[model samples]
Target: MPIHGNKMKKVFCYSLIFGILQLIPIRALGWGFKAHRQLNYAAVFTLPPELFKFYKPHINYITEKAVNADKRRYAFADEACRHFLDADHYEKKVPIDTIPNAWNNAVLKYSEDTLLAYGIVPWHLQRVQYQLTKAFAEKNLYLILKLSADLGHYAADLHVPLHSTENYNGQLTEQEGIHSLWESRLYELFEPNYDFFTGRASYLPNVSETIWERFAQSFAALDSVLIFEKLAGLKHPNKYSLQSNGRTNVKVYNEAFCIYYNHLLNGMIERRARASINLIGSLWYTAWVDAGQPDLSNLKEEPLKTENNDETLIQTLFQNSRIIGRKED
Candidate 1:
């Protein structure tokens, strides 16, 4: 939790980091994205093939909703929790304690939103699992896919630093590129090393503290992203230059960008990697738990039962999954 001044409380915010337009590689100013798709892809490979009996269907569900993020359907759907999700919900000028009951209600509402957005993954899984057991309810394909979509979106959101920040994409501070740097460029450079494979699920402990920690890390990183970039840009404006490779000329990632990013990001890469891996694993496990621990088999066959039925199911799942698309804050 932010150290609330005893005086009065005013601001509460969540980062909106996902919708950036471009990925700029200015050396160490952002993640080198050395890992790219490696870790997540590896996690998929590690899943027990037999689980594909279930996994394949979920993948199909998410794929179908892949465009929803762009369409802002999720954002609209998530508007229900806007108080907690929006960085603007809290006060910038005053203390939190000074706020009236109206603000308190806003904070409470926000708390619920935060819970749903960040922690809904496991719950979604659990719900599906329950339905699956209570009379072969797997046929509720729409519910399955829709809820899965929400989870995918939330998971992706968690990886984004700006998603956890009050300023989010930096619209609040005029530091817009910070969103892309945290998600896109970082994924582009260091994603390969992220250990998406965390084995099977485990019991979930109380996640309140965990979520708060995530917010803190992202909020903290925003300073470095903005400050270092500005400081570096001042001293070495052109220190970053792009180079042409055969296929496409990549930004040669300037020294200033690297130096500044490293200065700000520091251990965030490793911290994020560990969190990402465990989070994925935890979500999967929670889903299984929520699913009432149904045996991988014995569940009914695909609803449509087409040869490509798996494809359809896979397209239906979401909140977080493979970077089939753009980065989140």
Candidate 2:
């Protein structure tokens, strides 16, 4: 059963194109890649003097690696789940008290498959916090920097309203692809005016509760995110136009429509970005404090050799299972 060379070549070419397309940042979810990196970079400045010296020197690494988790989604089976929690998918729905904040307890209530089937962001975030704490305890420069960038990413994702809903991209509500539009397109257009000077990072007394509360707030705001977009569309019909987004010219909501939408939502993107900055810094501070506030002045930098390493891993991860939960993309 040997395949012909041409057929094999065609398959390989098609597969390569598909993988490249996935990484092209056309329209996925969760703040897009650029915004995540910017948030991580800014969060470094928010760290106190105690951890600033160590993190500031490696700010570029932290910033670039901030999207590591997003890239990992293609490779790691559970990586996508870590980015979001569609709490509404569970029977109890949002503000769900039935599922424990703890991993084992939650697994007991709803089997491991079930928990993974509906998203496990809060638990995954807690796990990452613990990892960061461990890294701080050991003073492992590599692990500390790696986990800090990673933890910041997950914390930021939790603040995204679309990430917390089953209808993440608004496909279910007939507002399909609204996830990228709200979180990505808006920020790409209006982030220059955002207030990123969100003060110093404070200690979070209860990390799990804080994360859960953030998700709850995000889910609560999901309705407005959708409704306002619908309203804006009605008010400004035929406002979309083809615009050059990188190498492609795609249809996008025009500047006027986007401004109208942003006004209608009372600056949701700015608020969420600010919230992400604060939360990322606070969580990093919390992990460091919980680990005895280790002095990292002497920590050395360990930059990743290949930025495209995750892409290779993603190609493999995608080959295994592209569908994690309710939505395929």
Best by lDDT: 2
Worst 10 residues of 1 by lDDT: 12-21
lDDT of 2 by residue, 1-329 (tens): 77689778757754674456444433234787779999999898888887787788789889988877875665555666777777777733456676688799889888998877778888889999999999999998888878998998988888898877778877777887687778777889889989998899999999989988888888888889989989999999876899885788988778888889999999888888988998999999999999998888776655654435654765675564343334434
Which window of ten consecutive residues has the lowest lDDT sum in model 2? 320-329
Clash statistics: count for each candidate: 64, 0
- The list of candidate 2 runs beyond 4 A from truth reads 1-28, 91-94, 245-248, 300-329
Score every model by TM-score.
0.54, 0.86
Q: Candidate 1: lDDT over CA atoms?
A: 0.42
Q: Candidate 1, residues 80-167: lDDT per residue as tens digits?
A: 2221232323433212232222333534665654554432222333333344334223434445444444343444344444443446
lDDT of 2 at 238: 70
